[model samples]
Target: MTDHPRSGAHDRLVTSLGTSIVTGELPPDSDVDPVALESQFGVSRTAVREALRVLSAKGLVGARPRRGTFVAPREQWALLDPDVLRWRFADRVDGVFLDELGEVRLTVEPTAARLAASRRTDRDLADLEDALAAMRSAGEKDADEQVTADLAFHDALLRAAHNELLLQMSVVIEVGLRLRDQFVHGALTTESADKHAEVLLAVRKQRPKAAETAMRALIEKSIADVEIAKKAI
Candidate 1:
């Protein structure tokens, strides 16, 4: 039931302009002249205005009296917004961005795992098991499958926590997983599965501290691997 952007002049303008802004082709504070955009995209002024409104809602652009539209500063951007995150991943994953994602994971995920240890339901466990099984079957050879499974595992973990705020973090977590998979070649390891297994065991045992520790260890290792990959790049 999601309203995907239609493949028309307005949607095309939105996507092209949003990507350009996010990727710094249109730097922050730069004026977004509506006439220029309309001419460039071969769209009407209304279409350009509509696209600008969408970007503004996502905190990617702002309008000033007599100044027209301008790209917003990085801090003003809605980084957690799903559309913005998708646009970001459309380009090469930046190391600084990855590090910021790692910091978020470290802050939120271990605590979520701890809560899951205390409150997980049978269905949650089933989902986690299914995700783990997918990971095992996919192994390192299937990057796409592995990333999907990896995302599912964390998604299940957050849902198991039963916190609405934590559940909301699933988008950011998925983006991080995709970025990791995209940048880190041959990154999946047996130890990764082992670490996830440890988390599952601790949660099943209702041991919050152990679950937190296991999740932290897994994320720490993932961040380390990403760091190594960044160096190689």
Candidate 2:
């Protein structure tokens, strides 16, 4: 598939605008004048319009027939969008945001684990095992590797559930996992590895109840760690 001719300009504008809104530089409800943006970014009006269209889709901005485009309210922002999530995490880790994200994981991940326990194939199990092995080898000392492996483990679990809708959530889950690990240092290490082991064993044994419980415990611990880190920050 060929890339859009203006995709580069569109993406740059999106990132610039998204970061501004997320960082409060473009305050909520403030007008986002396309003409002004075009001049500032040195992009054409077409590129600016395309960028605003993308941002609107992501819930970062809103447009109306009479009123011009403007930054959306925080409640209206698509927190699940990976780009939006990353922008939020870029400046600081908001405790309320972390709690909201935790609530989402608490609602989704345990159920996914339960489903995976019943639906996972041999290949799925192998993927989970590979991620776990990577995690173990990376250990606490290698934070970046640990985060990547940890994300891989969760991604494998979500796919193992064999649900398209749940699988679609991989990006949001990935963003949350990455931000948590990156900002909340010392949260995922031997302790998290052990918890993941419980989940892996449960899935391996095809114990849906155990898998659900293990995942719940793991997420709960992560939420606690996030809270602790929030206090520290």
lDDT of each: 0.89, 0.88
Candidate 2's TM-score: 0.91
Candidate 1 backbone collisions, by pair: none
Clashes of each: 0, 0
> Over the stretch 38-139, how does candidate 1's per-residue lDDT look in tens digits?
889898777787788888888999988988788999899998999888887786877788899999999999999999999999999999999998988888
Tell me, by TM-score, which candidate is best.
Answer: 1
| lDDT of candidate 2 over 131-153, digit per residue (tens) | 99999999888888898899999
Error of 1 at 136 (Å): 0.4
Model 2, residue 22: what's the lDDT? 89
Cα error, candidate 1, residue 122 (Å): 0.7
Evaluated at residue 15, the lDDT of candidate 1 is 82
RMSD of each: 2.1, 2.2
